[model samples]
Target: MLELNDISYMAGNRTILQGISFNVRKGELLMVSGPSGSGKSTLLRIIGDQLSPASGSIRLNGRSILEYRPEEYRQKVSYVFQTPTLFMDTVIEDLEFPYRIRSAAPDMERIRELLPEVGLTEEILQKESRVISGGEKQRVALLRSLLIAPDILLLDEVTASLDRENARMIENTVKCLSARGMTIIWVTHDPDQLELSDRVLRIRDGKVVESIA
Candidate 1:
């Protein structure tokens, strides 16, 4: 379980999160929802350790997150932002990055199998990253983020721009991952997406207003 104790954050003297606390159980799919600027994204960023909260503590299975080294923590916590960036030239180059970081050979069979699941085909791997459509780029980015199957996957509005078909592909893929024991904390405003969650946490003005379990 991940335990958050009285979390708070500040941005240029403005409060982004205030005295927030929550717990995420193992393999649970927790959906976070709120209006714009309510600090939903910031909360996920804090949990991902992409940003440090001004106060409070975050623990993963009884251990403080701070105890883990930066590189080691990142491998266990994956964060997928709303706007994806493909840093490499070809789709395959970007997809192969995780393997490179781990000093392992590219898992071609696994990559090939996952491509179709995200509404892409084998040929997309050869396509130039800069030329793909927005939906396609998001698909490839999402696929790459999941390649290693981190312990906790933080998704922030990943499918908000996708068409129904593509969005369902991502939704189903994460649902499958969650069932297989990869804990997912998904941030979405879509009602359909909310229905897919194991719990819903709603916040406003930097504070949690409601939580449905």
Candidate 2:
């Protein structure tokens, strides 16, 4: 469903990625694990269109990624950063953003169901973003985007902050969503996280080294 061909990127004088190519089918969970500075997250950033590649072609559903409107493309393919970003005063405001942008009413019942899946309760929504613990903040940030349910999710070390139990809970939750047809590209350094992947791709020095199915 998504394709990348000979993707290459350079940061000033240094090469961040070189000749990377891979394709992920619909509803696939692709686990990326690699050493620091090996460009795992950089690959996701480029795929998410947050960074322009020096040379490459990316296609989604047989159309060039560049052909789609930026907002529209991002809506279908969302990227969650390693660090959470919640600028709003309350968590509810942040969760309401997807509905606000689409001019659609939110399914609060659906949202409330998702809360406990990520180890959060509905009452936490009224709390200030400043008062939440770091893990709570991250979960809320991740949950905010899940309210809209992007077709493809790009997660960058997303569950790393949580303890193993919570991390596994989050992994299982996302895996369940993936089984229901959401494609996921996850970058994680933790070996235990690889358990849920449909396929695992290991990269070193900006190139694929090991691939397991």
Candidate 3:
């Protein structure tokens, strides 16, 4: 399980997160909901190790997240942003990113299997990322994040910008991944998406006020 204990993050005089705590069990889908500036995304960033908390600690299993190697820690827990950022020009380029980052060879067969799962055809591999719809790009980003077999996924409003069909596609993908034992921590304001969660946490002023299971 991924555990957060009394986690507090401060920016100069302002405290962004205060005594924030939770546990994300293996294969569980945890949805964090809040209004803007409630620090949902910031919490995700802390889990992803993008930001450091002023106090407290985060542990995956029994180990401290801060003790792991930077690259290896990132490989173990992947973060997917709300906005898609494609590195290479083509769809294949985006798909091949994680492998490049880890200096691993691209798995063509795995990539082929993932395309249809994300509602993309094999032909999409050849298309330029710049030409694809925003929804398609979001799926591409998701598949890319999973390429490295991350044990945990941190998503920040990942489906917020997609249409109904695309949003459903992404939600289904997340469900499948969690079913297969990938821990998920997602931040969103949509109640519909929260319906898919195993647990729901309501955040206010950077603190968890309610936890519904």
Return the TM-score for each candidate structure: 0.94, 0.94, 0.97
**Two-way lDDT contest, 1 vs 2, winner:** 1
lDDT string for model 2 (1-213, tens) is 999999999999999999999999999999999999999999999999999999989999999999999988998898888788887888887887788788988778878988987779989989988888777877787788777778898999987777776677678778777788889999999998898899999999998888899
Give the winner by TM-score: 3
For each candidate, how many residue pairs have backbone atoms clashing (under 3 Å)? 0, 0, 0
Judged by whole-model lDDT over C-alpha atoms, candidate 2 comes out at 0.87
Q: Which runs of model 1 end up more than 4 angstroms from their true locations?
A: none
lDDT computed for candidate 3: 0.90
In terms of TM-score, which candidate is stronger, 2 or 3? 3
Better of 1 and 2 by TM-score: 1
lDDT of 2 at 95: 83
Model 2 residue runs over 4 Å out of place are: 103-105
Q: Model 1 Cα RMSD, Å?
A: 1.4
List the lowest-lDDT window of 10 residues for candidate 3. 112-121
Over 47-127, each residue of candidate 3 has an lDDT whose tens digit, in order, gives 999999999999987899978999989999999999999989999988987888778899989999887777788988999
